[model samples]
Target: VRLAMGARDLENNTVEVARRDTLTKETLSLDNIENTVADLLDDIQKNIFRKALNYRQEHTITVDTYEEFKEKLEEGGFILAHWDGTPETEERIKAETKATIRCIPLAGDTTPGVCMVTGKPSVQRVLFARAY
Candidate 1:
């Protein structure tokens, strides 16, 4: 409190006050378990995040053609491939390979190229996967 208020002497120590909002019902007794529960929740979130990161890193794949995409899909991973930027082409690839466009990254290779499935023009690659 003294440091926060820029006081240098103990006798002239400045006071500080703070407030925290709590969501527990008025009748529910916390009994000091709130900290324990918060710690457990933090640990659980960290574990889940690490598991997802590892899974994505282990399963990610990149392919340049429809044939390669099919082969990679059989192996089961996140596929990065050029898309023609049309729903029809996206649906056709999904119908043929059971892989769907999971996400289109905001940042990726911007060079124009032929689509992996339809040979149509595309501006960037998209992420494909067999979502669970």
Candidate 2:
């Protein structure tokens, strides 16, 4: 704080309180960074779970399967559909059909289903939304 205050010429401001934040520079490789990112993604998954719970509480509807979900796509919100994690379907869906995916799930047995667009078998449940 003292060094930053001096550098910023904040000595003239008496009412401006300052505090210092210290951080350590650990020796880390790209692998370490990748692991850290993975850890962060784990936390984000938890956060998303909470959000999903809230979403369910707020707007719960029943669609038994991917086929059923696809049949009801004319009306829109966030639609969860199985995908191959490709931009082609998502992008094409957005371009031709005007749907945007909000997100993909973190982990699940989300059963393989056909892509909402190409009718190809999907690997994961990719979210879908209608964009403005």
TM-score of each: 0.68, 0.45
Please provide, for model 2 over 1-132, each residue's C-alpha lDDT reduced to its tens digit, 9 standing for 90 to 100. 221223233344322222222222222233345565466556656777888889754542334354566555665556666665677766766676666766666765578776655667777676666666
Clashing pairs in 2: none
Compared with the true structure, all predictions reach lDDT values of: 0.71, 0.55
Measured over all alpha carbons after superposition, the RMSD of each candidate to the real structure, in angstroms, is: 12.3, 11.1
* Candidate number of the best TM-score: 1
Candidate 1 off by > 4 Å: 1-31, 107-112
Q: How does candidate 2 fare on TM-score?
A: 0.45
RMSD of 1: 12.3
lDDT of 1 by residue, 6-87 (tens): 2332344322321122222222123444564566457656767898989987888778899998887888889989999898
